[model samples]
Target: MMAVDKGARCLVLNGATLGATGSGVLALFSGGHPLSSAALEGLSATAGMASLCRVLLEQAGWEDGPGRIVAVTGPGSFTGLRATLALAQGLALGYSASLCGVTLGQAYRAREGWSEAYCITRARRDRLFMERPDGTVWAGPSGAIALPARAFVVGNGVSMLDLPQHETLIRADCTSPDPRDIYRAACHADDRPSLQPLYIDAPEARLPSQGLRPSPV
Candidate 1:
């Protein structure tokens, strides 16, 4: 594991697959401060992500690339999450930079200094991804999740669920965790994540009846 220095040049990437847009964010940080950022949106958000990152780095005058790369490991779009991780891993290898991973819930918690709160996000049409107050994450239908009587919910998926009428059911102002929050979490992370995609549910796609082709000898 590589320790992130206060002055290290860091690049943060977030493919917002949990939301409806399928959008993404890229930011450059130096001396523990954000320097520049770019947003990836629309239909080409996944396909053109790498090119955009390159352009962002070039515009920031980081020809040598970043010293560390931080990525959001998600329980969102399977393709989007895979694409983002693939790009992160490839760039890390090419630049010989340290790599770190953080979940949206983790980032939000870290940024807000929330010792306990349920962080939720959309998993699909009816299902939802939730990080429990105890730090355990899971995905399932919204109706299946049982919230505490005086629960505090934070995340974009809050609007999706049908909650009971309770006075203490608090909701946050923001829909999702910001990219800057992710950066802060990465900088102060006590343990380094495996940098793997956090898939709470299986992908929608399935293999063909014939199965996959064999690998070359």
Candidate 2:
């Protein structure tokens, strides 16, 4: 677990598992307690997130910005991950604050207090991102992935996979990891300063068959 100064203001961003309409969570913490939180909706709404965070900080008498920032690095939406990391990086730079990155799977596991669990999330159409208890990660079609018997399943993509009813499976109550859990995970996570998106599958964009024309000299 990372050591943090007492009463330090912290900001947590979790855009990895956005809702269908691009909704995500933003939370503020101080001394390991929540100060405020907001559920941002739609791209247009989230566009003003910086202002919203400023307002929240002001309300809490923290006009200078947070002392630290925690961002959820993802194996989920590519756009969401990129936007979130960019925002976190910008905020950290602007405020001269320390930045930390945590994964959704790590948050879920910590919240569940499970030493062994399967963390899964949607990668794309028919594809899933699975993190085994042993820390191995795999990305592939849901049907192609196999789960252990009596597995403890956690994630938003749980419903997307078709599992056998005969096999015992325990699922978390929520589809997505809680933003608070993300903060908890950040507290225990290594202090690696990386903002890169954890993409499991290759991007869908491809080059056109016709190559670019030569430039005129």
Candidate 3:
């Protein structure tokens, strides 16, 4: 039988952009070892995440005190980010578990073999969220962000970059934050990471109102 850690277990959550053809994954980790992970593809993240949490808890066999919960805080689909953050926050509060938010950039940084890492994730159409090798973050149209020569690029936005040498980029299996990396981020996070979503643009519902209004001549 696997030994239980008594409130030392961790639950990590990650999701891809809505309609992005990737899976939402949740894992149960004890110590540094992953105990069980559950994933569902092509399901509505808003609904799917809640179901995933139950599956993960059952898979891990939680019986006692609450455990830690880690969630990825955007730079991806607005809908996906909202759903994930809400689910994680709810679970944390319900279980009285420690909660932390790991930015998508942080997940990429946790990966090995990339000193000059340029983390990028899809934003709105033709736009992206990019973390430069120097650690500066910017979000704008694809052509707006400049890339240094030979910087190792990763993330879902890489495909949309249309770079000359696409062969040089390090594309991940999935565009979403890797669950393994999310776990690492939770472990090494300073205190608690912010739970705020990293939305680069205001909601479309407010866009029309944001336009400059005509003034009296």
**Residue pairs in candidate 2 whose N, alpha carbon or C atoms collide under 3 angstroms:** none
Q: Write the per-residue lDDT of candidate 1 for residues 1-217, one digit (tens) a residue.
A: 4434533888898884623554568888877778888876644687888998999888877787898899988756787788888898888888878889987777787766564668878777788888886768888888887777767788777877665653467777766567788888787764342477888887678798999989999
| Model 2 lDDT-worst window of ten | 1-10
Model 3 RMSD in Å is: 4.7
Give all TM-scores, in the order shown: 0.84, 0.85, 0.83
List ranges where model 3 is wrong by over 4 Å.
Answer: 163-174, 206-217
**What's model 3's overall lDDT?**
0.72
Compose the digit string of candidate 2's lDDT tens values, residues 131-200: 8877678999878888877788887778766657514777765666677888888888765555877788
Cα lDDT tens digits for candidate 3, 1-217: 8676756788888764554544567788887778788775653756777876786687667855247888877666777878888877888877878888877777777777654568887777788888775556788988777776556778777878775655455555546656788887667885463488777667765546578778989
Worst 10 residues of 3 by lDDT: 15-24
lDDT of 1 at 217: 90
Q: Order the candidates by TM-score, highest first.
A: 2, 1, 3
Model-by-model lDDT, in order? 0.77, 0.77, 0.72
For each candidate, C-alpha RMSD in Å? 4.8, 4.1, 4.7
